[model samples]
Target: MLISMKIVIISSLFPPNSYGGAEQIACAEAEKLAREGNKVIVLTLKFDKGYACSTSDAKNLQIIEVSHKNIFNYYNIGKKSICLRFIWHIIDTFNFRLANDIAEILKRESPDIVTCHNIKGLSLLTPLKIKKLKIKNYAVVHDVSFYTPSGLIEWGKEKSWEHMGVLTRIYRFFTRRLMSYPEKIFFPSRWLLDFYYKNGFFINQEKLYKPNELGFVCENKSVDSGGKVANNFLYVGKIEHHKGILLLLDAFERLKPTNVTLDIIGNGVLMSEVKKHAQTNPNIKIHGQISREKLPEFYRNAKAVIVPSVVYENAPNVVYEALSCGVPVIVARIGGACEPIIEGKNGYIFNPGDVDDLVEKMKKYL
Candidate 1:
């Protein structure tokens, strides 16, 4: 027997506007719930020239896009000055306006379960609002944004929740207090789950180490051309310093192996630098931001996918995607990035920030 209930999912972003794995997962979760005969409501942000609000419905799902009332939209945070960014975070912390908007939707929908993902832009006080309505609220941890606004901790440069400045300490104190409103929380990896627990964030809440859902299974679509396995490698992610794009490029250049190629996907602030490297290295190809539906073609042909993130990731989707496609993975051993790799069976792991270790591992497929 199957039972269907009304569910409301709140995320900062949703499909079409989704820029990362977290948003994709939220969309998938909503669709799955709707397909199971449940009425699903997704409350997310709308980004336009003026941040317009709109609503639409399809099948058993309804999407309500609320305009953010902060100084600027969340997507423009990178372009703002430090002072403006600080002010924006403060406004977003409590976000009375945004909470009121979401509260209205929750009250109308009166959902059975309220699940939230990456509520940074949506509002940190979202869980508290849901609880105020006496609804069962659950949150999913996607990254380290709760600890730091940037959601980043460099592998070699940053300390582990230590040596916080006064402002940062104050920020975390309030963020931690507000986030504790969730009845139960889900984490994509044990590293992230432990991170929150160790920082004394969600001490009384029930925590579960639930790995990210694949959303869709990929079929092995391409047959290998039958050549040297290491001849062609793939990297799919943001092209930025924290993602270790430069490090991967440097290693590939050092390898300097004949007939070897590296296909880089995705785009970010480091696009110009990546382009400069691509211009210099004939063996490296930059395919900027391939659609999700078209990624399997690249995965099936490549010998292995390399995740060279220097930041402490909370389990990336690429590793799982590659393994599901029957391709091996060579990942950096930092945070939860290396959690899924079984070493020699599915993939291999190298010490983070170690060029020699990465090159040595790259040699195996050569």
Candidate 2:
């Protein structure tokens, strides 16, 4: 008399659609659970790019793609004032019709447990509908901002004051009230849990579960260590100030290594500034948005992958990616990024914005 649970994963993003930290975690966890003999299916939004639509079963996991149009896709929005963000939230949360469609799917499929990742893009309304349908549900909070509005404001990008404003506050207040409908809340890091606790989001800490590292089994690939004499460092994330791209560049400039080069492999609002900086310094190279498939190649060839984020990240997949590829990581000692690093064992860590410390750390590896 063992009970087998049918789990439905509701995430805003999924593999081959978009590659974000939360999406990766959802993908990995679903695969793991499926491998463990539990029926796992993913309900995710399909981007307009129309890359691949066919679904294939592997490792006992199934992925269902619900097509989505990019109307209020705030994933691209860099930063905005509190007022503008509040308005965006209203439009994003209410105007979208995806929730109704998702609710229909939930009614049809009737999964025993529903696990949600990022619902901002998909609209929280859908989950509410699932609750009305009396479905057992759970949510994984990948970032602190989901619980509190003012989480990442200090990143020097467009701020979402509106989401942190009066309207958002009202919405959050109600949302917190409805949060108890879910049986459990999963957090990738303790920092996120503590942030929510201090902000008065969850009363009982028992609801929070760590689930630290996602299941990431690296596929065996040929490694090529031989190349040109130029020593290289790698950065693999959005080109934003909060990611500490500017800080990394500033530190690289200060270090002034004649033979070392830094390769930036993502795109964002700071692209123009990063491009301008790269123009002045031939040592810095911006490769703008590389596909997820191509990321392993970058990690395989680099001296070390750098994750210099200024904000409190829940858990960065890049750190795991670097480790999986057998490449070392140099990260900032803030948030969940420090969870994997052993402070010189497998990787190195530096103060969040300390250019001098970063320079010194870079010198050790180079």
Candidate 3:
């Protein structure tokens, strides 16, 4: 018989304040564990505009939002300047105050295990606190944030280890010790796991390439003949430079298919540029970010999905979500984005930032 155990899940963000896939994945794990008769306690940062604590619909689930004393909240980082961001990273690297807050919570709850995900905003030294308290600790790598604060190095512009910038070298120096405190570390992609290994991380911990759960249930909408509801291609993710949103837009424009339409979802720094492009092109439509409940409808209505990230994306949620809906994917041949795809099979892969290569892949679906 399986005994119910208390599990503490620590994430930087959760639903209602979630900006990306990592948060959703964390929420899904917590809810699933709760459903299985485990006492799941989720500790996350309290954003300025969000509730102090989240009320969950799942039984045995409790959420406690703690304030991380910092220059600014993590969610609104895009609005801050480079100098503020640099200071934030410095404070986050060795935030003993926030670590004490986490220690107090752990002392009160005294859970069986502590699992951390995306702990940049919440504090990277959290594992160190957990270690000192003799808690069984596990961690999930959602991105390259531990090595580089930006969580990205452009697709082809990645630097060699010795040639890395001072920021990354310094960040990794601290994180390398902090990361060792975890008993085990989970990675969503083998490529990402290897990247960390090459960068000399998690040498003393058990590393597993465990893909993320889709987080939502969606009926296979592409059950019909040809598996397409319309001539629409969907892009659902952050509109950031490393996401290759501009590359996607440029490729789509160059293709200039009259019968096909492109629908963009989500919001970010490049939102204005996307809007400008949409204004000039009737075939392009920008719906901005929508509720997760409504994402299936968009996936169902789309002929295909595109993930054109220029960064080392570790198994993006969109790839799994689109596949679950039976929608084919066309992704950049970088990072783990193309790991789930088999050329000319369920989806296609193109060279990252190569507009012509992307157009060629899109032509197959069109």
Candidate 4:
């Protein structure tokens, strides 16, 4: 029998406070680790208003929410100069306070292994801190944040990811050096692994693991629908510009599929645009944020789930969720989102940011 070990999950955000793919994936892994008889403790940055340090409990998970000097949690960060943002990241590159907090937590609850995830608010200095304790550690690369300040590089149209400027190169060099602190590294997609390897990341790391913690056995799906639901499509992910919300809106408007209605179920920077389009067009509806527990019901009844991400996705949990409910998927052919989907069977893959192609696919539903 496999032994259950004590595991610490460190991520930028956790469930109930998550708004992106990485956080939700972290939450799933933490919960799964707990259910498998391992002790799981989640040390995540808290982003809610008026929250200091707090503790909470889930079925088999222990959550420690740490408040920090973050751009997301504080409004003052909005007014600061762009240089200041760089400074904030630099400070956290080996943040003294962040290390101390983790050290203190370690004293109280020692873990066998620490798994790291998106550390934007937590800091890139996180793995180094764990190294000091001499514990087995590995980081899950959900984005390019470890190598670049913005985590996202310019892609689309005629642009692909390229080398950064002098300052950015310097920033990435130091972070990439620090990136080697972990004993091992984990990737959710081969594309992410390739990105890091081609750029000389974790060259000296002990081992590498991929498709991390994304596979799950879906529960029996049952949702309360007053009557038979028809021709309803679902979009359950971030509403950012990079997620292609605007493209989806354009497609829905131009095509004007009378037999179909789109249910958008997430929040992000582009929420206003989603709402604006919804107001003018009755076919689009914004449900804002909904609990994960209730999402399967939406998926169970939907004709298909749309993942119109413009950027390369490591692997989207929503895509898996949709498939688990026996719902078909309509995803962009970028990175790992297209991996799980078998075209014309469970889903269709379209060119990234192609509104007309998306519309043509939607027309098939009617």
Candidate 5:
């Protein structure tokens, strides 16, 4: 006999809040699971404008929005400091009130399994509360940066990192104590899992799952290729230093391919620099933050999509979105970006941060 289970997905961001890739994946997964005949529900933070909280069975899914103002909105060096991090952690510990509220919902719903995606905006206190309640829980780590507080302290902005020093060290020391509470830990990439294992963060590798292998489904249908006329190469993602946006711009400047253009989507702190580069160079066009509905059009019209992220991204939705549109990708050889691309087959790869190699690769595509 087969038994059906009810799943409660906890995330910090959800649809209508779509801040990054983690939000998109959580939305997609919840919808998919709901369609699969399992009762699915999502709990996410509420935006300032507020979100609609009601039962929508249209997609066989239930979306529950819990309202909470995000304290960490923009990058504040003071707030991100080690002393601040500790203070924030102490304050966040009181977020057990929010977790207890979530626990009440879980008890009322009586879900068989509690699955959590990104909860950076929410609180880790919720999971611990749920575990104490004796609920079967799974926490999915989208990125390794959050596992240890030191990871954030090291990789975050210099000012923030400096502020986070001693407090972050303390947090890192106690991370294992908090982390070991989770019954199951889900990692999107083998590379991430191995990295954590090597770092002694995660001992049991069996808990990690490579869900990216299943591939993502694109909601928009692929546009007919015959009518598309643009010869532009697309790069869709946040314009951060870690994303290697500057590297891409440098490479594109070096190539200087006549009649070819580069369309950059999304906005970030480095927007001014990127804009300055675009102003001097006529070939680069910056389209800041396009809606998900409009992304298909960008992918379809592009000659190819470029993913030049320098950091080890677990699995970027942009790559999946591009491939789903049948648009070939030219991604950096580092991280999980190279997982989908078969070199010359569906896409191409170049050395991370190598402007010359990237320029050569761009020229070949042009």
Candidate 6:
């Protein structure tokens, strides 16, 4: 059966103004829908007024950039203290200007389905507005941002700390209870939905797991070690403590596999630390930030991609990209990192934050 639908895709960040995995998935899904004969409109935040609050129809997609300046960026918050960053996180969610812009669009478009991806930069009230308009609303939980300010559940902390802060508690109430009230909600992986459920989310609402759709696909993917390289382990994401980079470094240093090498890509606050380690270690290569066009080459030329995230990641796009190139993954046993990997088949999973466990998993390729 052929169906034509009006779909309003809402995300806080879009491509060319990337935030992370959420933007990549949102943009790709929206474009895919537009190509499938649906009338699609993408609502995303635009910090620069020069972009304008106008519509552009290209490749069968309509993009509406809502004009709003984020307080964190306006103050240049890189390398700032945790307290200051938390303040920014609070302000980012309770945005009223972006809300008005989206609400007005909803009124005019009156789309059949209001599909929301990430609403951190915009406002969580987006789905509420959609419901108010009596439209079928769907939301995708690509992150734990609704529960925690940084979307990270710190490792080794007691669960008590999760609801310790008043701001976090309030945010959780809205995100966990109110936001989950959408007509339907999607999780990219079972681990993600389970994580939310274990934390008391999805109260009296519909939820399901839908694997993230990748932007590209490689043909003739094989289970054999048929990638371009045999002994190269790759890590593509932020270099941060909560991401388990420090633990990975320590594990790699202590393990010291004689025949294999490790490659680190992307940027973050821990650049200096990674650079220092790269200076001391010859096997560890720091590529900084590589262009998107050059990413596949890296994935193809690697034995396996390492996702050592200690936080509760939803479904990392790196894993999808790696799989698309027929490269296996060695993932941490937390969050969605372990969801895609099939032990002894496609990839291996090790206890998160456990150096010895990671070393054992890495040795399989080494």
Using lDDT as the measure, the top candidate is 3
**Cα error of candidate 5 at position 245, Å:** 1.4
Cα lDDT for residue 78, candidate 6 = 46
Error of 2 at 96 (Å): 9.3
Supply the global lDDT for candidate 4.
0.75
**Top candidate, metric TM-score:** 3
Clashing pairs in 2: 79-158, 80-158, 82-161, 82-162, 86-162
Candidate 3: tens digits of C-alpha lDDT, residues 1-366: 253999999998888788788988898899889989999999999979756645469888998888979888888777888789889989988888998999999999999999999898888789999999999999999888887877777876787552287776888898898889999999999999998999899997999989876834666665324664568899999988988999999999999999888999998888998999999999999999887788887887787899999887988999999988878899998888788898877899998889999999999977
- For model 2, the superposed segments whose C-alpha errors exceed 4 Å read 1-5, 35-38, 46-71, 74-84, 91-98, 148-151, 155-168, 211-224, 227-230
Instruction: Report the C-alpha lDDT of model 5 over 115-168, residue by residue, as the tens digit.
Output: 888766466577777788888888887775454443222223435543356755
lDDT of 2 by residue, 44-102 (tens): 76665655532336455777777554344444333666666666666555644777788
The superposed Cα distance between candidate 6 and the true structure at residue 150, in angstroms, equals 1.8
TM-score for all models, in order of appearance: 0.93, 0.82, 0.95, 0.86, 0.84, 0.88
What does candidate 5 score on TM? 0.84
Ten-residue stretch with the least lDDT total in model 4: 215-224
Clashing pairs in 5: 81-163, 81-164, 82-163, 82-164
| Worst 10 contiguous positions by lDDT, candidate 3 | 220-229
RMSD of 2: 4.1
Q: Can you give the lDDT of residue 122 in candidate 5?
A: 62
Question: Candidates 4 and 6: which is better by lDDT?
Answer: 6
Residue pairs of candidate 4 with colliding backbone atoms: none
TM-score, model 4 to reference:
0.86
- In Å, residue 27's CA in model 3 sits off its true spot by 0.3
